[model samples]
Every structure is written in C-alpha cells, then in structure tokens.
Target: MIKQDAASRTIEAIHESVRTYLKQGLTNEQIIEKLKEENLEPYYIETVIDNIYKEYEDKKNLKNAILTGSILVIVGLVINMLSYRLSENMNSSAFLLFWGIVVTGIVTIIRGMILYRS
Candidate 1:
C-alpha cells in the first residue's frame, strides 16, 4: 500500500510538470531538451515530454484563435466609431453598425470553433 501511494504521488507530480510545460507553450522537442537537463529517469522524462508537446500544440492553437478574435473585435469597434462620426445619413451609420456586428460575430465564432476543437 505504501509503495502504491508513493507511485501515485510520483505520477501526479509528473503530470503536473507536463501540464506546466504545455501551458508554457513548449514544443515536444523543447520539453525533451528541458527534461534532459533535469535528473529524472530517462523513460519517465521522455514520455512526459512527448505528451506535453502534443497537448501544447492544441493549446497554442486555441491561444492564437483568441488573439485573432480579440483583434477583430477591437478593429470592428474602431471602424464602427469612425464610420458613425463620418456618415451624414442615418442609412450609412446603420450600415456601418451592421458591418461591425458581422465582423465581430465572425471572429467570435472562429474563436469558439478553435476552442471547441482544441
């Protein structure tokens, strides 16, 4: 029982390390390099590093999606404001708002899809 407990704890620690590496956007090869510098067992370090790289790729995609969506939303806001002030007719102002909404919605949907896929 004591041995089992110790094994479980060790596994948990390794998993946490992998999670940290993934969050930091480390590639599989990058993680392997880092792990090699540590004093961990060869097999254990390699396995964890491999898994972390796969997971990190997915997470990095999601992060990029979010950034793209945020940029679109900000740009849409600027366009909406500038268009509203420059327009002379109510129709043009409304059209600008519509375009802004469409852009914001498209970006948000893209971001959601990426996050869901990840």
Candidate 2:
C-alpha cells in the first residue's frame, strides 16, 4: 500500500512538472531534458510528449477535415443549382456528374463526422 501511494505521488509530480513546462512554452526536447535530470525514465518522458503531440495533430486534422467537407458540400450544392438554372436541358452525362459530386461531398462529410467522433 505504501509503495502504491508513493508511485501515485510520483506520477502526480511528473504530471505537474509537465504541465508547468508546457505553460512556460518549453520545447519537447527541453522538457525531456528537465525530466531526465529529475531521473524520470526516458520511456515515460517520450510517451508523454508523443501523446501530447498526437492529440494536437488529431485535433488539427479533425478541424481541417470538417472544414473541407463542409466546403465541398456547399460547392456541390451550388454547382447543382447552377446547372439546373443555367441549362435548358440537362444532359445525362451532366446529371451523372452532378450526382457524383453530391455523393463525394456526402462521403467526405460523413468521414469528417466520424473523425470528429473518434
């Protein structure tokens, strides 16, 4: 029980140190070096940094995907409306192309939604 308590305290201390270094805007290398000086394991330091970076990347990607998807959907809708309004007779080829754009836009939006949820 004492060992477990000590381990918990140690983990909490490490987390606090990480948060402090991050708030100070230290680079990952600097933070790693500081943690090393504290005798923290290299694996633990690397894992923490990796997780932080991965989460940041995930958020960025999610934002980009959602924005792109929304734009594509809006563009597809505009194109369909323009085609209908501008053309007296819609050709079969153009109809197919319109449906294709709409389908692609829908798929992209769905993919973005999935990424956001994940």
The top-ranked prediction according to lDDT is 2
Q: Per-residue lDDT tens digits of candidate 1, residues 23-96?
A: 88887667667766776766777777666566677677777767777777777777777778768555553545
The parts of candidate 2 lying over 4 Å away from their true place are: 1-20, 36-39, 88-97
The C-alpha lDDT values of all candidates are 0.71, 0.77
Question: Tens-digit lDDT track for model 2 on 8-99?
Answer: 99887887788788889998889999999988888899887776667677778777777777777788888887777666365434442366
List residue ranges in candidate 1 displaced over 4 A. Answer: 1-8, 16-47, 88-95, 98-118
Model 1's lDDT to the true fold? 0.71
RMSD of 2: 4.9
User: Quick one: how many clashes does candidate 2 have?
Assistant: 0
In model 1, residue pairs whose N, Cα or C atoms come closer than 3 Å (at least 3 residues apart or on different chains), thus clashing, are none
**Location of the lowest summed lDDT over 10 successive residues in candidate 1:** 89-98
Q: What is the number of backbone collisions in each predicted candidate, taken in the order shown? A: 0, 0
